[model samples]
Target chain A: MPSETPAAYDPSAYPPFAVTVDLVVLTIRAGALRVLLVRRATEPFAGRLALPGGFVQIDEDLLPAARRELAEETGVRLGRAHLEQLGTYGHPDRDPRMRVVSVAYLALVPDLAQPVAGTDAAEADLVPVAAVEPLDRLAFDHGRILADGLERARAKLTYTTLATTFCPPEFTVTELRAVYEAVWGTTVDPRNFHRKVLASDGFVEPTGETTTRGGGRPAQLHRQGSAEQLHPPLTR
Target chain B: MPSETPAAYDPSAYPPFAVTVDLVVLTIRAGALRVLLVRRATEPFAGRLALPGGFVQIDEDLLPAARRELAEETGVRLGRAHLEQLGTYGHPDRDPRMRVVSVAYLALVPDLAQPVAGTDAAEADLVPVAAVEPLDRLAFDHGRILADGLERARAKLTYTTLATTFCPPEFTVTELRAVYEAVWGTTVDPRNFHRKVLASDGFVEPTGETTTRGGGRPAQLHRQGSAEQLHPPLTR
Candidate 1:
């Protein structure tokens, strides 16, 4: 039996479980929300698409582990992405090989070059969120993890300045609005969205420059502000 | 070196880590937000107040492990509480003995009898949120976990209808307001609060009953509504 005394709690007496970190790296590409996926190269589910992830190292912290796994599999550096802990999944039977606990992370990155699979993944691709049949295509419990990450992203858009993470450092309000449109798959009235975005204290601030990217007229450029949360959350 | 091939991923090759579940159970007592804490009875930080927790069994799921730990440490049944996964803590130096990844959970329960300490804890007590010196008093990394749980609960009250979790099945608007007051640690104008609560769609609905709990005029009783979120959330 495992130790019953708190002071005498012996970790070695209990069965040890492997801890892994999984990344749900999301980006807005071609007017759609897409997630980074890797084709598994070996047997548990060979050739199957899965979220890029790997075992956490003994010397690293959770975030560092996530960053390492992401970089190793997808060749994406940590500095270019915004990552946060999504949740942990530890069902007794989540892994067939053994008891494995996964600390899932959610990441958002601006448009970048297509990912090149490195160490463990056979191939890396950005799959549209709408096209992912999580239950049918992904290996293990990745589908559930992906769904939770998407939900968290969607919810964060409502109350946090997270949407800005999907845009360039300097972007137009229209570009920012497009992010919500792509992720939510719904058109928001530009006038209303503009008013609401500006009204929410510290959501965004003018950068004093105008940009005319693929546009007929120059639009005011804005940057993310210091606020972490929106007072009157922009609910969907 | 660890396997670089995805198909060749082996769990046994890498070092295994022990997993545990910790609970940051919160409730309101005497109009103060309180958290359930146990005095460690053994050598690692013995005699310190820490969040009630224990090792996760091999066959049990994360939630079940948390439920079992809560019951064993405090005799609080799972059914009377609203529990959710908070986050996972796994810094390499977090535990002095070995790598122990803890899946922390946050629970909210209605009024209940004082908890009786079990096998591991020397004593269990409800500590007011304001009094917790998380950085200095708690064992392991519990102070950080407790702080995170408290922040989550405080933020949840702003957007989610989580305050209802702190009230009885049937309660008055005043009682509901008290839940907010205790959690937020601020006074809200009663008239404004009443108007806002009634205006927020699906926040609460009358149960068509009233009670004179403290010998004053009976106030209409209300219950939680079906809405998971409060539109135009109650900001602190």
Candidate 2:
């Protein structure tokens, strides 16, 4: 504890730390929640699967840095993805090469084509959330990060209109309910869910279109409305 | 970007960053929500009000760093303060001296004795939230950080039992409603609020005691329950 005086201050005397951004890009495909992961090709955790990320550039903003790491490691563009800051991790020993503090981001995106491993990763692929554990383990505390991201997604889906991010621009009520079922790993009553969703004003608006993609009859398509937060959250 | 191989890797090549922790310690005092602030004793923003904070030590964890800075700058020992990480702010030019990434924390504490400025601050005091802006402003990006913390507190109050943190161990249902009023800066209907709180199970439980400190009939005391997230949130 030294006195706070300019004459005695030395900014360069502080310890140096490296900052990086890790992304937990999630999407639902075939009624399953999946996360985009990469096989690391570097030393500390060589050839092990991890959430795609890298060292942030000096002049880059935190959000852009996360998107850059996502694109560079997986070669998948982040177009129309719902990206947000999840949290930051600084366990001191989380990275072995040096003291690295990583800012983690959560992204909800529509299912796209399979990712190609970019220069940063040995291989890249979308792994099902349920199939990830008790089988192939992730590297460098990634399992914990992925868990947090999933919880955030599940919790936000209950109170916000973010579930539409997992669907296409136009989606049926059944398709949107499947997002909640996939993320929460539970089945929701179709009649009850449809009534609640239609009751929540500013949550969804009809597109004046019909889609018979899934069977039975042509269901009306809807899109996310202008509400940022739901008043009476849809309780599961 | 180079090949991801140990032989060609240089961890030292990454840009260096100095990490710090800034806290938004809030409390309800005199029917108003107040924040703990310090007058910087050093250059950059000397003699101006800023949230109490400091650089993180080389071996300290982020939460401990936040607690240490609170004690060091405002002489506030954070006993029983509800503390949590709010977010991380890292604009490239936020700190004129260097690139400093600050992890902001939110702490909801019961009102305590007047603060004595510690070694890091020239002066310290609790300022009303409504009185902060359009008058003396905070240093750096602290204004934005304060707004984020305030929003978090207001939002969490609607869905969580954290509003009790602003009160003593034993409190009447009426006193609890005052906490919501002070933080949200609005009037809450007393009868409706009491009915809602009592209806929400695991939100509050009767203490089998009564208090008559507010010049009314003996009011039954209640304490927070075991629930983390409310099912049917007590909406305002």
Candidate 3:
């Protein structure tokens, strides 16, 4: 408090901190909510399961950091994915060694035509959300990050048009409905959901095509709509 | 890189870092969305304007850090306020000297009754969101944090019942509508907003009394209802 003036604040007074970005990349592979996780090749928790992450570099914002980390770890381009800033993880003890603050993001990628793992990563796998048994045991506070990401994704579906992020470029209404059911962990009335979708004009438009991939029925195909936000949002 | 197995990452390998929290405390004052900001009383940016904030302690969660900073600088108890994590700011050079990761939060105070200045704050004042000319040049990257907080508040009002957080525990319908108008920076159709509120169900409930303060038509008194989430949320 020696200097009462703000201009005199010495930049050297505080210690430098290292910042990193972590991602809980989510996708639906084979009708299940799956999270993309990586095995750490380095300690303190080396060999344990964790999310794909890296130290955020200079010359970029937090959003780009998340994108960079995701791409580096998974070799997947997040351009078409629904990316958002989840929150920050900054418990002094969250990192045992240095004061490393991590900015976490929730990303939704539709089915990938192919997924390649990072070079330094020991192992990378898509684990089902329901299969994260004893959810409390994830390494390095990642369990908490996963839970928060799931809740944010669920809540976003209620008011935003983010459910489509989990679908293919062209998908059937049935496929869209499945996305909601999987994320919410509850079954919604198909009829009601269909009616609601149609009522919300401009939310989706028919592509004059059909999909025969699912086998049972030839469902009409539709691409993503232009609605940035849902008016009178579809509530859970 | 020497060992066949990855080396045990030592906490001591990296330099120690500083952690801090910045708060965007908002309320509706004088029919405008107002934010609480403080003029820096100490260096880095003494006499210059900045958001109310401080360094984080050795043991504290990101949110608790934000809340503690709020109370210390603004003398406001965050226990009763609507507080939620906004996001984190952690650019490598966000702090000129070292790496300082700042966790930012958006808090809504129903009523900002009295503010006492302490800590590194010069004078805590509620500045109109539209009148932040002097605050445009904030300490560090806080100008960006404030802008992001305002945008979130505006968007949140559209889908959630968070606008009520800018009002007192008990308020009238007109007052509630005013909250929306102020935050969105646009006037809403009173009749439409009122009908929408009633139809939403559980947003507000009658207190069986009328406000005796207003000179015009006496307004019905109401209190916050039990609606946890707004389905088919009110949009701009």
Candidate 4:
């Protein structure tokens, strides 16, 4: 058992740890859910796919570090992405290089912009989540992180207004419903989803504008609302 | 901008970090929400209150380290405490000694054990959460961590079976409602609360037993059920 407090704890003598940030950037592109990933150009997991991230600067805080790493590593700006801390992973052996503690972040970005390979990435692109499965397709424990992020994203859609993050600035209810469909990977009844979306207080606000993009009828445009939570959640 | 991948990335040159686990052991005591805190035995806010936690060992996994530290630092065992990662806090100057990244765990334990002074802690006690307000009463950035934990606990009670973790093996609906009132710091109509608790699918299962412990005409004793999430969540 280690002392909770040592008489005069020596900071320099503590275990050497390398702290890094890993992002699970998710979005809906072409009616399917996708995650941004990069090809590692370095060893240990060389030439394999992994989440785009980098070391957290000694002076930077966690959120800013995550946002910075996303841009620097993948050449992708968050741009209104709903970024949140997913979890932290420290398995001692998770990193063969040393004792590395990775703070994983989940970024839900709108369906816009693509990733380009950065200095640390050999190649960068959005891969359909459907294609990445069985937890071994990606390098290290990244697959697990992605799985957790996906789960959080899916569950949140039922009780949060986050689906709007996957839509454009103003979108039709049909388009909003598509975001749910894509992320949840399940078809939600249009009438039911529309009613539920409207019923959920502050889930969205009508822009008083109409769009023909949804086809059939001139659909009303709406934007994300102030409320973050959905009472009487839209269950999957 | 740093490269996501360097031809042969030098891991040893990365910034050093001290990773620690901070526990927010919350329990319902005397019909009030309480958290376990320890008085720092050494400098860096010595003798001031903070969450009970310690350094993560080189070869230890995070969850195990949290469980181990909780027991070691406060002389308190989890028993069946529902412990889960709350979030991670990494502010460059959070710990004056070094750049420390703390992985915080939220523990909802049954009201059973009390804390005693331990090695690193000069004094240990369960402090009422209501009394530890304003976010600046505690040492370090622990106050912020405690706030996050409390918010999570309050919200989870609305949609998860986690509230049972604060109760003994067999308890009446009244006792369970008290957990909610204490944690949420709001009073709910007892009839409505009882009805909602029993209605949440698999939230609790009858033990084929009754309890005069709650007074009144003997209430039914129930134990936690298999369901982790409440579909029709009990609203706060």
lDDT of 2 by residue, B32-52 (tens): 999987777676777667887
Cα deviation in Å at residue A105, candidate 1? 0.3
Candidate 2 lDDT tens digits, A79-98: 56788999888877777777
Tell how far residue B220 is off in model 4, in angstroms.
2.8
> Least accurate stretch of 10 residues (summed lDDT) in model 3 chain A?
A1-10
TM-score of 4: 0.92
Per-candidate TM equals 0.92, 0.92, 0.83, 0.92
Candidate number with the higher DockQ (1 or 4): 4
- The Cα error of candidate 3 at residue A12, in Å, is 5.9
DockQ of 1: 0.50
The complex in candidate 2 yields a DockQ of: 0.47
Q: How does model 1 fare in lDDT?
A: 0.81
**Tens digit per residue, CA lDDT, model 1, B1-236:** 12264454566677689898999999888999999887776667777888888888888899999888777766767655788999999999887778889999999987666655666637778888888864567888888998899889888887777788788888888898999999888888878888888888888889999899946888888888778675666746
lDDT of 3 at B11: 40
lDDT string, candidate 4, B1-236, tens digits: 12444555465578888899999989889998999887776768776788888888889999999999777765556766788999999999888877899999998888755545566636777789888756786888999999999989888887788899999888899999899888877888999888988987888999989979766798999998778775566755
Q: Top DockQ: which candidate number? A: 4
Candidate 2: lDDT of B164?
81
What shift in Å separates residue B118 of candidate 1 from its native position after superposition?
3.2
Better TM-score candidate (1, 3): 1
Quote the true-contact fraction of every model. 0.53, 0.43, 0.38, 0.58
Error of 1 at B231 (Å): 4.1
lDDT of 3 by residue, A1-236 (tens): 11233454454465455566788889998878999887776765776778777766555667887887777666666657888888878776777756667888899888765764665546778899999856556667888999999988877787777788888888998899999878767788888888888677667778999989878879889877888485455646
List the RMSD of every prediction in angstroms.
2.7, 2.7, 4.1, 2.5
DockQ of each: 0.50, 0.47, 0.35, 0.52
